[model samples]
Target: MSAPSAPPLKLLPLILANAACMMAMNAFIALLAPLARTLALNEWQAGASVTVAGVLWFLLARPWGRLSDRWGRKRVIATGIAGFAAAYLALAAGIHWALLTLPGILAGFLLLLAGRGAIGAFYAAIPAAANAMIADRTPVERRAAAMATLGASSAIGLVLGPSLAGWLVGGGLVLPLYAMAGLAVVALIVAIYGLPGGDAPLAPRDATPVRMRDPRLRMPVVVALVAMGSVAIAQICVGFYAMDRWGLSREHAGRVAGYALTAVGVALIAAQVGVRRLQWPPHVLIRRGAVVAMLGFLVAGFTAAPWQLIASYFVMALGMGLVFPAFSAMAANAVAAHEQGTVAGTVSAAQGIGMVLGPLAGTLLYGIAPAVPFVVGALMLASIAFWVGTAREPAVARPADEAA
Candidate 1:
């Protein structure tokens, strides 16, 4: 089938809502180390907070996707947005109290963990439903480009979040946290009022459950795990890398980290723009993007100057922007209409698992030596690129419901 003339107008609200949430989340992540210091927590503790939240995200994302299939995308998406707003506010409040009251290290650590865990559990709903909605509307031949539009929303968020946080952080660390909460509120409003209403079409009760190890999904799942795992590790460590490698102060490191992350976001947007124009098949995009990402990591592992480090981050994210949409399109095209929701959820679950492993492993390796993790990450990406290039390309087949 030929692609649609244009995506439906209803996609605007979903795009806006997802962008807002992504901005809030990435902003917080960029400022994690500085925020951890303010709350009297250590590096390990901060990393643990991400690990716990990722655990919840990984465990629940599939179920939430399945729920969206039954409960309707708008309702599930709205609930997720509402929960995101509430959870962010609660986290901000907890941080404020910890700062004022001088909570013990353990108390402060647990507070951040609980707050992040709550946010992750709900935030999983937003992306899964939104992606499934796009899958519902787009045909197989156009799937990658449509998915690229959604990925662009995330890239925009990544761009705005760290840039805004870096600017606001000069006022105070807490200021950025509050700003994130405000974005969530705006997203919640859009999700409630702007998205289409009514139920998603139901699938049969006995539709085969999508599994992580399914033949159709195995390569995509592996790609999600490696790509996201590398990104998470790099993100969680960049601030510390700035401080230690460049000899910047904590505050200065925060600023530098923000700038570096903003570079990543810009590159992501640039690459996705290429994806839209080039319209490469899923296999080609996956293979080429992976090779680019591996080169970026290799540069990052050995760079001697701050400018070089930032450049490497830009290169890395540019490649990721290509890989994400391509893999998502591959997975969606491999599944049936009724299975879109579950597939999207399973993809997210794989990403969550990557998040869970990346930070924990990254931090530990960093403690041993700053460059070790990046070098290892480079090798992992190289391996994946080779694997993708050697594998046979999956045939894109339209589902009966979609063809009709």
Candidate 2:
């Protein structure tokens, strides 16, 4: 007889862990301007401090995914959370000491970079393992829904983290960092005790390993890269765009940017929730989402007022909401069961690369024209929609609904 399937509640710990990690990252992001001011660093330096983490995450995500495949997912996740917590605490301490002692600014900046890079390195384990776990636990048809739950958790965290940081940063810059570190610790404890253990390879040893360059993976991977890069471009450019286009003060521009992102997060949650119920094929979702997102970006590029920009961004986010989970599910479905971690890693790496490139490209383009990045992003999405609409869907084997 086949084993019974695992309950959906089994996914809770991993989802919560993913939320905590996202919270830490977003909290730091919310404080970037303040951090730069506190360290007496220039804009480029402040940006570089944040960029180091994304770079490391891009470099290390695949290796961490492979490690999760070799080690158990739970163990890898727990260790990563603990390491992130420690690194966060150390970063806070280093910043506090530097501010008080007037250490050479370069030394303080390097310390911050090291800590951020460490967080990125360790935190890489969570997504690969969490995604692999979702694949392990869910049936083929339910994979998109499962991935949506994971995506929703991340969206919720993205909203909460920045909100908490904005509220707490009034007391001190370090307060939010410490709070995020505490949250990471809580996630670590939950991961160790609540998460299920022992992830044996799903595919047999004789099965061929999935590769990043595999033809089956190419379209989904490209979609992921372009979609994430578009997001990063918007994120990096929005505040500057608002200030330039609307003649807003720095503080006002930041508030406007925050509102725009909040809209994006809400749209993401709504889309994922709606998507899980529709039971549409991943390719269809990708194509439709890309079209919607492209229109949103196009509208954003031409907006004359702040509200219009925000609305355009919301529409764009709605499109992304459909696209992100579908792409993840598509990548997951493309691979053999044993290759889940590897594929997850590859997806994560693609996102990482996008994150790294998006900001650089967006900022450079912004120097030429405030609206250039948004238009460029829209075109990129247009291409993705066309590609996914035309590309042949990969053949994924659907197993009997046995215990995951």
Candidate 3:
């Protein structure tokens, strides 16, 4: 007889919850400039507002993952979403008060920072729990597809969040922020009622804890660092590049950036959906995707036209879409079942580091030259592709005890 499979219903809540979380996160991101302007803050302060979240996410992801491992996936995820909703509401209130009756802009800025920090702290739990849950339910052979499904959901949310925010911000910035909070509340409800209550440990309760130094995890972790960093570099530099190269106004450049990012999101969704159906090994996917992305970046660096840049970004996005899910699957497979949360947290922390550094590096490079950041990003990705392509896949330990 065939082995029993995970019910389709079980995965739905995870997908929806992930989508909602990402949507809320990106909505805030989409409104950052406007938020800064409304509060009469400088560019540095505006940047710091967003940076606070990334910094907190980097510091707190591991602890949240470990907590989820001990407590339970559903509970942690639900609680996190609920907290995310509260944070969004708080952030909106901060902005509202700043506009209406705050003593000073600084007071509102501090409240906004606090709210963003809360979001980073609580939002960290969702991805770690969701990824660990996938690890718990999926077998090794099907893990990539499972991870891809989650990735697709996230991509959709990223796309929708900005679009929704852009539309709602026309009515008022506060409206969109509240809408994001509402979405989070809905996600919390779904997570509580729809997700499974119990999580069976991947290994026996007595299994040794997986160390971060495990050979199997090293390559994927490195890849995650480079991939996320490259993405961040590209993201941060694109708008500046558009303005400098195309001689567009800030408003026009912002719109161009949005269109380019939307192309990337569509490409990512398409590529991940396609890759999930294939049975390629993680290394193979990583190598090919990195090469494609590298090529795209190189092309983008040389492109003079707006359309050319957007098209190149789409190619890069397709490659990144494949790389992310493959790396996630490989990392999850590297350890015994019980170590999923740890590995997921580690991966999140790595990506968070990338987010923290990418902007700084990209901006510095952009000051040197318009195309320097893209060229550097391409070089980094090329090196990653070569490294991953040559590295040997480590043997994965089974979840079941050999002595049994």
lDDT by residue (tens digit), candidate 1, 182-238: 999999999888988654656678777877777778777888889889998888888
Better of 1 and 3 by TM-score: 1
lDDT (tens digit, per residue) of candidate 2 on 67-93: 777786788888888988999989888
Q: Each candidate's TM vs. the true structure? A: 0.95, 0.89, 0.88
Error of 2 at 107 (Å): 4.3
Identify the superior model by TM-score, candidate 2 or candidate 3: 2
Name model 1 segments beyond 4 Å from true: 1-9, 395-404
In model 1, residue pairs whose N, Cα or C atoms come closer than 3 Å (at least 3 residues apart or on different chains), thus clashing, are none
Question: lDDT of all predictions, in order shown?
Answer: 0.84, 0.78, 0.76
Error of 1 at 334 (Å): 0.5
The window of 10 residues in a row where model 2 has the poorest summed lDDT is: 395-404
Q: Over the stretch 55-74, how does candidate 3's per-residue lDDT look in tens digits?
A: 77778777767776778778
Candidate 1 lDDT at 183 equals 93
How high a TM-score does candidate 2 get?
A: 0.89
